[model samples]
Target: MNQSNETTMNPPLNQESVSLEPSANLVRTIAVRERPANPGAWSNTVAFGWRALLKIKYVPEQMFDVLVTPIMFTVMFTYLFGGALAGSTADYLQFLLPGILAQTVVFTSLYTGVTLNTDISKGVYDRFKSMPIWAPSPLVGAMLGDVLRYTGASIIVVLIGLVLGYRPEQGLVGVLLALVLLNVFGFGLGWVFTVLGLILRTPGAVMTISWLVLMPMTFVSNIYVDPATMPDFLQTLVAFNPVTHLVSALRGLMSGGVTLGQLGLSLLTPVILTAVFGPLAMRLYRRKR
Candidate 1:
């Protein structure tokens, strides 16, 4: 009788142990499956960047802004404002080409935010979060891929300018350097837009906000006309404008007369913008979820 009672009690304990074993194994299996592989930052960034490039391949229309817009603006502004602003199209082309390149690259950077916001709204970012890649891979990769657009715009503007008889007296090397500087500035400025994308509700709203901020700066700067020609108040505004310094630096590098002061300011502007906006963007990105 005692043996029977002990056996009955012991059976329950054995069954409990059996049940616990499977539960523990199941938890281990789940943990192993859930743990993602840690690819280093550089490799992850490149992989994600390739994804962005593939997106452009599938949707070639995205190139329109970099391709068509630069051509149209180069032509329109050269003819429309050339004669009035600088006496003739040929003379104006020389002065206007570099400025146009600056404006085109800077303006193009705005789209980075718009596209980012679109991705977030579409739940693409959430999908990314599920992957094992570095948290910042998406954002950094997108921005890196955008360097191509900036380069394309710079090339298109320069090619159009060449066709319009706008010569870069600084030659190929100088033109290349100027392009490098513009891309740097564009990349740094893009971080600010990235932060906006993180916080904004819609892509359209991001674009509108970017335009409102950019238009006034572009119009008031020395991109089109000499700041000296403007009234005192406008000139004062131009004097402090970072765009003005960028244009001046480009003109100097491309036209063979960039001053030390202009070069220093041009280099410093991107550094300052990146320092301030880059961390802000990353912080916002981390808090997104």
Candidate 2:
């Protein structure tokens, strides 16, 4: 009776062991499933870059500026101020094309910040946060994807300028180099806006602030007029503006007057900007809830 009672109280040892094996295996399986596999940094960045590109597929209108703004600005500025600024539309187109290219690329960079802000506001960032990827992947990816915009704008401006009789004296090589430099500068400058988006309250606010800052930079630099023609104080400001160096470099490269020194300065500007703003933006991004 005692033996029977004990046997009933507890299942056979082999049977109990068998039951526990399934439970242990189930826990181990769950643990394996719960842990996410980490990918390489570059892979993550490229993956997220594709995600950003996919956004444009669903909303083709996002490319409106890249496609249309360059044409409008090239035509308007070439005609409106060409005679006053350079004595004729033909003369001005050469000078204006490079400047217009610079402005378009720079302005388009603002979209990076605006879109980032929109994502944050809509809680899209939260979803990104839950993913098993490098933390800076999203920012880096967005910036990389924006290279398309810069490249498109550069191409459009150059094509329009060509149609309007603006020839690049340095030939295909110089034009390609100019395009490359512009995109690099634009990409680096974009970090400034990324930081703004990370901390700013709204996309509208980011746009407002970006425009307020960019308008003066674009207009007051050597883009539209000779700094020598401006007032003394304005000339001093223009002399120090990074855009002035960039425009000078592009003008030189395209018009066949490029010097090694000018090219160095142009390249250096983006390097400095990226050095300062890139880490700051990443720090701010990490701090974001």
Residue 25 C-alpha lDDT in model 2: 91
Candidate 2, residues 229-254, lDDT tens digits: the string is 89999999998888888999999988
Query: What are the lDDT scores of the predictions, listed in order?
Result: 0.88, 0.89
- Model 1, 75-159: lDDT tens per residue? 9999999999999989988888888898899899998999888776656777788877778788888998888899998998998
Q: Give the local distance difference test score of model 2.
A: 0.89
Candidate number achieving the greatest TM-score relative to the actual structure: 2
Clashes of each: 0, 0
TM-score of each: 0.84, 0.85
Worst 10 residues of 1 by lDDT: 30-39
Each candidate's root-mean-square deviation in Å?
Answer: 9.4, 8.2
